[model samples]
Target: MSDPKSLGLLAQFETPADIMHAAMAVRDAGFSKWDVFTPFPIHGMDDAMALPSSKVGFFTFVGGVTGFFSGMGMIWFMNKFDYPLVVGGKPLFTPLFAFPVSYELTILLSAFGTLFGLALLNRLPKLNNPLFSSERFKRATNDKFFVYVETADPKFSAVETRALLATLGASAVEEIHDTEA
Candidate 1:
Protein backbone atom coordinates (compact mmCIF):
# COMPACT_ATOMS: atom_id res chain seq x y z
CA MET A 1 0.00 0.00 0.00
CA SER A 2 1.11 3.53 -0.67
CA ASP A 3 2.03 5.75 2.23
CA PRO A 4 -0.29 8.57 3.19
CA LYS A 5 0.46 11.83 1.38
CA SER A 6 -0.26 15.36 2.43
CA LEU A 7 -2.47 17.50 0.23
CA GLY A 8 -1.24 20.47 2.27
CA LEU A 9 -3.19 22.67 4.65
CA LEU A 10 -6.55 24.42 4.55
CA ALA A 11 -7.03 27.66 6.44
CA GLN A 12 -10.44 29.13 7.14
CA PHE A 13 -11.19 32.79 7.66
CA GLU A 14 -14.27 34.57 8.93
CA THR A 15 -14.30 37.54 6.57
CA PRO A 16 -13.34 38.46 3.03
CA ALA A 17 -10.73 40.89 4.28
CA ASP A 18 -9.04 38.18 6.30
CA ILE A 19 -8.93 35.82 3.36
CA MET A 20 -7.63 38.53 1.09
CA HIS A 21 -4.84 39.31 3.51
CA ALA A 22 -3.99 35.62 3.74
CA ALA A 23 -3.92 35.30 -0.03
CA MET A 24 -1.58 38.25 -0.42
CA ALA A 25 0.65 36.93 2.31
CA VAL A 26 0.77 33.50 0.72
CA ARG A 27 1.62 35.06 -2.61
CA ASP A 28 4.35 37.21 -1.11
CA ALA A 29 5.76 34.17 0.65
CA GLY A 30 6.59 32.69 -2.78
CA PHE A 31 4.16 29.79 -2.63
CA SER A 32 2.99 28.85 -6.12
CA LYS A 33 0.48 26.07 -5.65
CA TRP A 34 -2.15 27.76 -3.57
CA ASP A 35 -5.77 28.76 -4.06
CA VAL A 36 -8.55 30.59 -2.29
CA PHE A 37 -12.26 29.80 -2.13
CA THR A 38 -15.04 32.17 -1.26
CA PRO A 39 -18.82 32.11 -1.22
CA PHE A 40 -18.83 34.81 -3.87
CA PRO A 41 -16.39 36.77 -5.95
CA ILE A 42 -14.13 39.11 -4.00
CA HIS A 43 -12.73 42.25 -5.52
CA GLY A 44 -8.93 42.50 -5.74
CA MET A 45 -8.45 38.80 -5.01
CA ASP A 46 -6.97 38.27 -8.46
CA ASP A 47 -4.41 40.99 -7.90
CA ALA A 48 -3.65 39.65 -4.43
CA MET A 49 -3.08 36.18 -5.89
CA ALA A 50 -1.08 37.71 -8.77
CA LEU A 51 -2.85 35.51 -11.32
CA PRO A 52 -2.45 36.32 -14.97
CA SER A 53 -5.23 37.11 -17.40
CA SER A 54 -7.08 34.09 -18.78
CA LYS A 55 -6.25 32.76 -22.28
CA VAL A 56 -9.80 31.78 -23.15
CA GLY A 57 -10.23 34.96 -25.17
CA PHE A 58 -7.41 33.95 -27.44
CA PHE A 59 -9.07 30.58 -28.05
CA THR A 60 -12.36 32.27 -28.88
CA PHE A 61 -10.63 34.58 -31.33
CA VAL A 62 -8.98 31.69 -33.12
CA GLY A 63 -12.24 29.81 -33.36
CA GLY A 64 -14.05 32.84 -34.74
CA VAL A 65 -11.36 33.43 -37.37
CA THR A 66 -11.46 29.78 -38.42
CA GLY A 67 -15.23 29.85 -38.69
CA PHE A 68 -15.19 32.99 -40.79
CA PHE A 69 -12.66 31.59 -43.26
CA SER A 70 -14.40 28.20 -43.38
CA GLY A 71 -17.74 29.80 -44.07
CA MET A 72 -16.31 31.91 -46.88
CA GLY A 73 -14.47 28.94 -48.37
CA MET A 74 -17.54 26.72 -48.26
CA ILE A 75 -19.69 29.39 -49.92
CA TRP A 76 -17.06 30.01 -52.58
CA PHE A 77 -16.51 26.29 -53.32
CA MET A 78 -20.23 25.60 -53.57
CA ASN A 79 -21.18 28.51 -55.81
CA LYS A 80 -18.03 29.20 -57.86
CA PHE A 81 -16.58 25.72 -58.37
CA ASP A 82 -18.87 22.79 -57.46
CA TYR A 83 -21.89 23.97 -59.44
CA PRO A 84 -21.52 27.37 -61.01
CA LEU A 85 -24.61 29.42 -61.43
CA VAL A 86 -25.35 32.84 -62.98
CA VAL A 87 -28.44 34.74 -61.99
CA GLY A 88 -29.17 38.22 -63.37
CA GLY A 89 -25.51 38.85 -64.13
CA LYS A 90 -24.63 38.48 -60.41
CA PRO A 91 -21.15 37.14 -59.51
CA LEU A 92 -20.84 33.51 -58.54
CA PHE A 93 -19.60 34.61 -55.06
CA THR A 94 -19.61 37.91 -53.29
CA PRO A 95 -18.74 39.04 -49.79
CA LEU A 96 -21.96 41.08 -49.62
CA PHE A 97 -24.01 37.95 -50.12
CA ALA A 98 -21.92 35.74 -47.76
CA PHE A 99 -21.70 38.26 -44.91
CA PRO A 100 -24.81 36.99 -43.10
CA VAL A 101 -23.82 33.35 -43.02
CA SER A 102 -20.19 34.16 -42.20
CA TYR A 103 -21.21 36.44 -39.35
CA GLU A 104 -23.55 33.83 -37.91
CA LEU A 105 -20.91 31.13 -38.14
CA THR A 106 -18.26 33.34 -36.53
CA ILE A 107 -20.56 33.98 -33.59
CA LEU A 108 -21.48 30.28 -33.37
CA LEU A 109 -17.90 29.06 -33.35
CA SER A 110 -16.82 31.77 -30.93
CA ALA A 111 -19.53 30.70 -28.50
CA PHE A 112 -18.42 27.08 -28.80
CA GLY A 113 -14.83 28.15 -28.24
CA THR A 114 -15.73 30.09 -25.12
CA LEU A 115 -17.65 27.16 -23.67
CA PHE A 116 -15.14 24.42 -24.47
CA GLY A 117 -12.16 26.61 -23.68
CA LEU A 118 -13.53 27.48 -20.24
CA ALA A 119 -14.30 23.83 -19.53
CA LEU A 120 -10.86 22.67 -20.58
CA LEU A 121 -9.00 25.48 -18.85
CA ASN A 122 -10.89 25.03 -15.59
CA ARG A 123 -10.69 21.22 -15.73
CA LEU A 124 -14.40 20.81 -15.40
CA PRO A 125 -16.59 17.68 -15.19
CA LYS A 126 -14.82 16.81 -11.94
CA LEU A 127 -17.44 15.26 -9.68
CA ASN A 128 -15.26 14.81 -6.63
CA ASN A 129 -12.37 16.42 -4.81
CA PRO A 130 -10.52 15.62 -1.57
CA LEU A 131 -11.65 18.97 -0.16
CA PHE A 132 -15.25 17.81 -0.26
CA SER A 133 -14.52 15.44 2.59
CA SER A 134 -14.09 18.35 4.98
CA GLU A 135 -17.36 19.38 6.52
CA ARG A 136 -16.02 22.86 7.24
CA PHE A 137 -15.25 23.33 3.58
CA LYS A 138 -18.94 22.91 2.89
CA ARG A 139 -19.39 26.36 4.38
CA ALA A 140 -17.39 27.72 1.46
CA THR A 141 -20.59 27.84 -0.51
CA ASN A 142 -22.39 29.67 2.28
CA ASP A 143 -20.30 32.05 4.36
CA LYS A 144 -16.69 31.04 5.06
CA PHE A 145 -13.61 31.69 2.95
CA PHE A 146 -10.71 29.28 2.61
CA VAL A 147 -7.15 29.34 1.41
CA TYR A 148 -5.47 26.06 0.54
CA VAL A 149 -1.72 25.70 0.22
CA GLU A 150 -0.84 22.54 -1.64
CA THR A 151 2.04 20.37 -0.51
CA ALA A 152 3.13 20.18 -4.14
CA ASP A 153 4.60 23.66 -3.78
CA PRO A 154 8.34 23.78 -3.52
CA LYS A 155 8.28 26.04 -0.46
CA PHE A 156 5.51 24.31 1.44
CA SER A 157 6.23 23.16 5.01
CA ALA A 158 3.38 21.98 7.20
CA VAL A 159 4.48 23.63 10.40
CA GLU A 160 5.74 26.96 9.06
CA THR A 161 2.90 27.31 6.57
CA ARG A 162 0.26 26.65 9.17
CA ALA A 163 1.93 29.11 11.51
CA LEU A 164 2.04 31.73 8.77
CA LEU A 165 -1.64 31.19 8.07
CA ALA A 166 -2.50 31.50 11.73
CA THR A 167 -0.58 34.72 11.96
CA LEU A 168 -2.50 36.00 8.94
CA GLY A 169 -5.71 35.77 10.98
CA ALA A 170 -7.03 32.41 9.91
CA SER A 171 -9.68 31.27 12.34
CA ALA A 172 -8.87 27.61 11.84
CA VAL A 173 -6.28 25.59 9.95
CA GLU A 174 -6.53 21.92 9.03
CA GLU A 175 -4.34 19.54 7.13
CA ILE A 176 -5.77 17.91 4.03
CA HIS A 177 -4.59 14.35 3.37
CA ASP A 178 -4.51 12.63 0.01
CA THR A 179 -6.94 9.69 -0.03
CA GLU A 180 -5.22 7.96 -2.95
CA ALA A 181 -1.84 8.04 -1.30
Candidate 2:
Protein backbone atom coordinates (compact mmCIF):
# COMPACT_ATOMS: atom_id res chain seq x y z
CA MET A 1 0.00 0.00 0.00
CA SER A 2 1.10 3.60 -0.56
CA ASP A 3 2.53 5.49 2.41
CA PRO A 4 -0.19 8.15 2.23
CA LYS A 5 -2.91 5.55 2.48
CA SER A 6 -1.27 3.99 5.55
CA LEU A 7 -2.27 5.86 8.67
CA GLY A 8 0.25 4.04 10.91
CA LEU A 9 0.27 1.31 13.53
CA LEU A 10 -1.79 0.61 16.61
CA ALA A 11 -0.35 -1.34 19.52
CA GLN A 12 -2.70 -2.73 22.10
CA PHE A 13 -1.62 -3.51 25.65
CA GLU A 14 -3.51 -5.72 28.05
CA THR A 15 -2.68 -3.58 31.07
CA PRO A 16 -1.76 -0.03 32.04
CA ALA A 17 1.71 -1.05 33.21
CA ASP A 18 2.37 -2.68 29.87
CA ILE A 19 1.27 0.43 28.04
CA MET A 20 3.35 2.63 30.35
CA HIS A 21 6.53 0.75 29.57
CA ALA A 22 5.67 0.77 25.86
CA ALA A 23 5.14 4.54 26.02
CA MET A 24 8.56 5.07 27.53
CA ALA A 25 10.13 2.92 24.86
CA VAL A 26 8.41 4.82 22.09
CA ARG A 27 9.51 8.13 23.61
CA ASP A 28 13.14 7.05 23.88
CA ALA A 29 12.97 5.89 20.28
CA GLY A 30 12.28 9.54 19.31
CA PHE A 31 8.88 9.04 17.69
CA SER A 32 7.07 12.38 17.77
CA LYS A 33 3.62 11.88 16.22
CA TRP A 34 2.34 9.30 18.63
CA ASP A 35 -0.30 9.17 21.33
CA VAL A 36 -1.50 6.91 24.09
CA PHE A 37 -5.12 6.32 24.96
CA THR A 38 -6.27 4.87 28.25
CA PRO A 39 -9.58 4.26 29.95
CA PHE A 40 -8.59 6.96 32.35
CA PRO A 41 -5.83 9.45 33.06
CA ILE A 42 -2.41 8.02 33.91
CA HIS A 43 -0.14 9.84 36.29
CA GLY A 44 3.32 10.69 34.88
CA MET A 45 2.14 9.77 31.37
CA ASP A 46 2.98 13.33 30.42
CA ASP A 47 6.57 12.67 31.45
CA ALA A 48 6.55 9.41 29.51
CA MET A 49 5.16 11.19 26.45
CA ALA A 50 7.71 14.00 26.94
CA LEU A 51 5.05 16.59 26.36
CA PRO A 52 6.09 20.17 26.99
CA SER A 53 4.25 22.57 29.23
CA SER A 54 0.94 23.81 27.81
CA LYS A 55 0.79 27.18 26.02
CA VAL A 56 -2.77 27.75 27.21
CA GLY A 57 -1.61 29.49 30.38
CA PHE A 58 0.27 32.08 28.38
CA PHE A 59 -2.90 32.86 26.44
CA THR A 60 -4.83 33.17 29.67
CA PHE A 61 -2.30 35.56 31.12
CA VAL A 62 -2.31 37.81 28.06
CA GLY A 63 -6.09 37.80 27.93
CA GLY A 64 -6.34 38.73 31.60
CA VAL A 65 -3.89 41.61 31.22
CA THR A 66 -5.70 42.87 28.15
CA GLY A 67 -9.05 42.53 29.87
CA PHE A 68 -7.92 44.42 32.93
CA PHE A 69 -6.39 47.25 30.98
CA SER A 70 -9.29 47.43 28.55
CA GLY A 71 -11.74 47.51 31.44
CA MET A 72 -9.82 50.35 33.10
CA GLY A 73 -9.51 52.19 29.82
CA MET A 74 -13.18 51.79 28.95
CA ILE A 75 -14.28 53.05 32.34
CA TRP A 76 -11.91 55.98 32.18
CA PHE A 77 -13.04 56.86 28.69
CA MET A 78 -16.71 56.67 29.59
CA ASN A 79 -16.60 58.33 32.99
CA LYS A 80 -13.74 60.80 32.58
CA PHE A 81 -13.85 61.76 28.93
CA ASP A 82 -17.07 60.67 27.22
CA TYR A 83 -19.54 61.90 29.79
CA PRO A 84 -17.80 63.34 32.78
CA LEU A 85 -19.86 62.94 35.91
CA VAL A 86 -18.72 64.07 39.34
CA VAL A 87 -20.97 62.54 41.95
CA GLY A 88 -20.64 62.45 45.77
CA GLY A 89 -17.43 64.55 45.66
CA LYS A 90 -15.53 61.62 44.20
CA PRO A 91 -12.87 62.10 41.48
CA LEU A 92 -14.17 61.74 37.93
CA PHE A 93 -11.83 58.79 37.18
CA THR A 94 -10.83 56.85 40.25
CA PRO A 95 -9.32 53.41 39.66
CA LEU A 96 -11.11 52.21 42.78
CA PHE A 97 -14.44 52.41 41.01
CA ALA A 98 -13.12 50.57 37.95
CA PHE A 99 -11.56 47.80 40.04
CA PRO A 100 -14.71 45.61 40.17
CA VAL A 101 -15.38 45.86 36.45
CA SER A 102 -11.76 45.24 35.64
CA TYR A 103 -11.66 42.22 37.95
CA GLU A 104 -14.75 40.71 36.30
CA LEU A 105 -13.45 41.40 32.83
CA THR A 106 -10.14 39.81 33.71
CA ILE A 107 -11.91 36.60 34.73
CA LEU A 108 -14.20 36.67 31.70
CA LEU A 109 -11.48 37.12 29.16
CA SER A 110 -9.27 34.59 30.89
CA ALA A 111 -11.98 31.95 30.51
CA PHE A 112 -12.37 32.80 26.82
CA GLY A 113 -8.63 32.59 26.37
CA THR A 114 -8.46 29.20 28.05
CA LEU A 115 -11.25 27.81 25.85
CA PHE A 116 -9.75 29.09 22.61
CA GLY A 117 -6.23 28.12 23.61
CA LEU A 118 -7.21 24.55 24.37
CA ALA A 119 -9.02 24.25 21.04
CA LEU A 120 -6.09 25.78 19.17
CA LEU A 121 -3.44 23.69 20.88
CA ASN A 122 -5.30 20.45 20.50
CA ARG A 123 -6.31 21.09 16.88
CA LEU A 124 -9.90 20.89 17.92
CA PRO A 125 -12.88 20.40 15.62
CA LYS A 126 -11.04 17.36 14.37
CA LEU A 127 -14.04 15.43 13.14
CA ASN A 128 -12.20 12.27 12.31
CA ASN A 129 -9.04 10.21 12.82
CA PRO A 130 -7.79 7.20 10.89
CA LEU A 131 -7.39 5.33 14.18
CA PHE A 132 -11.14 5.27 14.51
CA SER A 133 -11.18 2.70 11.71
CA SER A 134 -9.67 0.07 14.03
CA GLU A 135 -12.31 -2.19 15.57
CA ARG A 136 -10.01 -2.94 18.50
CA PHE A 137 -9.51 0.75 19.23
CA LYS A 138 -13.05 0.90 20.58
CA ARG A 139 -11.69 -1.00 23.56
CA ALA A 140 -9.37 1.91 24.30
CA THR A 141 -12.13 3.73 26.17
CA ASN A 142 -13.07 0.55 27.98
CA ASP A 143 -10.52 -2.08 29.05
CA LYS A 144 -7.63 -1.73 26.61
CA PHE A 145 -4.76 0.74 26.50
CA PHE A 146 -3.32 1.71 23.14
CA VAL A 147 -0.37 3.56 21.65
CA TYR A 148 -0.77 4.82 18.11
CA VAL A 149 2.26 5.92 16.11
CA GLU A 150 1.37 7.94 13.05
CA THR A 151 3.11 7.25 9.75
CA ALA A 152 3.65 11.00 9.49
CA ASP A 153 6.26 10.89 12.28
CA PRO A 154 9.78 11.58 11.11
CA LYS A 155 11.15 8.35 12.60
CA PHE A 156 8.31 6.10 11.53
CA SER A 157 9.23 2.95 9.65
CA ALA A 158 6.52 0.37 9.03
CA VAL A 159 8.77 -2.59 9.74
CA GLU A 160 10.74 -1.06 12.60
CA THR A 161 7.83 0.59 14.38
CA ARG A 162 5.82 -2.59 14.29
CA ALA A 163 8.75 -4.63 15.55
CA LEU A 164 9.43 -2.14 18.32
CA LEU A 165 5.86 -2.21 19.57
CA ALA A 166 5.69 -5.98 19.35
CA THR A 167 8.86 -6.21 21.44
CA LEU A 168 7.43 -3.77 23.95
CA GLY A 169 4.92 -6.44 25.02
CA ALA A 170 2.06 -5.24 22.90
CA SER A 171 -0.62 -7.92 22.97
CA ALA A 172 -1.60 -7.04 19.44
CA VAL A 173 -0.01 -4.82 16.82
CA GLU A 174 -1.96 -3.83 13.75
CA GLU A 175 -1.29 -1.46 10.88
CA ILE A 176 -4.00 1.13 10.37
CA HIS A 177 -5.17 2.27 6.96
CA ASP A 178 -6.83 5.55 6.31
CA THR A 179 -10.55 5.46 5.45
CA GLU A 180 -11.30 7.90 2.69
CA ALA A 181 -14.57 9.65 3.25
Q: What is the per-residue lDDT of model 2 for residues 50-154, given as tens digits with 9 covering 90 to 100?
A: 988779998899889989999999999999999998899889998998999999999999989889889999899797978788899999999999999999999
Show the colliding residue pairs in model 2.
Answer: none
User: TM-score: which candidate is best?
Assistant: 1
User: Least lDDT summed over 10 consecutive residues: which range in candidate 2?
Assistant: 1-10
Model 2 regions lying over 4 Å from their true place: 1-4
Model 1 residue-pair collision total: 0
Candidate 1 clashes between residue pairs 3 or more apart in a chain or in different chains: none
Q: Can you give the TM-score per candidate against the true fold?
A: 0.91, 0.90
TM-score of 1: 0.91
